[model samples]
Target: MSQPSSRPELTPRFCFNQTALRDFLRLSRSTIDDSITQNLNALLTPSTTAFNPTSTSTRSVTPPSSSRAIPAQTCTSFKHNVLFPSWASRSDVLDYCAGVATSPDPDDPDSVLRQIEDEKVRERVVDERLDPYSGRYFPREARTESLAMLMRNERMVEKVVRARTGSVVGERCGEGGGLEGEFDEWRRAQGSGRR
Candidate 1:
């Protein structure tokens, strides 16, 4: 049996071709549209609509009296109860919450201790794994390049849509009555504007 070499193998970095990326984005328009529709439906659909008491009940309901103000401790507890579970997935957030709950800092008027705790939580959560530019997480360069290409594709799609709808200016402006004429017109406009 041959032993494997101990040396680490270096792989070539893959760079995206702009044209191919644009084409891919154009082809994935339907998927993007479906996602947008799904997200919109999710946002529009009320979570509590089915359990709405007013819709089911025929009896007249009197609003509760607010003569007595809610206790500060009760209000704080209620707020914590509603909010803490949302951060349950994150350990850093849970640690911050636990620290805040345990430490009752009344001496510091500016709440510097709480701010420091918050900063610590932020630092813990925003490690190298969360870094967008770090190649350690992925073998790619900056995400901004992908974003720029996507934006360019979106602009191209928009231009195509406008041309199809006859909404684009000088859509039939060229001698050939196409994009060439529009380019010629744009060049002439630019030349005239320089003077």
Candidate 2:
């Protein structure tokens, strides 16, 4: 008979399937919840000082300075140990929601929440203009009109500035006909011509 093979047969390693992953996640969540509850309870309760067997003194030992006395009412919310959703547990999200709900400047037109709400309403109104494929809603016609209005306001301001200053600061020669044209005319009158 041939000698027995020196190398051992290879065996497949165990891998976590979807069910195993889910079960593990559930167990971990339960463990974390239990730990949090225990920690909170420990914080609320008064801790006893450890006995020093080596010392002969009869006086009671005091608790360490690190142990703080948590107020009873503060621990009430954590007493039930109900697990909140991830977003609800976040302090910033809670603060923002609270701020929006109890906004001091509710009547102010420039309030951030009011602005966001107005934008949301506008988006809803123009929902028909949304592109299904791209998932983008661009009211191009409205945007163009708004841009034109802004440019017109800018040109009007430029005209007023030209009239007040009598000299263009950074205005292009071809665009505004006020200061540029007048300056060119003055140069021609002086026999220097356009530079």
- The prediction achieving the highest TM-score against the true structure is 1
Candidate 2 C-alpha error for residue 89, in Å: 54
Candidate 1 C-alpha lDDT tens digits along 1-195? 111112112111111233543343343333322132232223222453457667666754654322222334543332233212111212232233234334443543345655665566556543566675533322233333444454555556644642432221122111123333433454466469789
Task: Name the runs in model 1 displaced over 4 angstroms.
Answer: 1-143, 167-176
Residues 1-195 of candidate 2: C-alpha lDDT, one tens digit per residue = 011112112111101122332233334333433244344444444535675676656664666422443453543233223222211222222233233334333233335554575587566633345655444444333222333443344345434533533222112111233334544443355455333
User: How much is 65 displaced in model 2, in angstroms?
Assistant: 79
How many clashes in each candidate? 1, 0
Candidate 2 Cα errors over 4 Å, as ranges: 1-141, 167-180, 184-195
TM-score of 1: 0.22
lDDT of 1 at 163: 41
Backbone clashes in candidate 1 total: 1
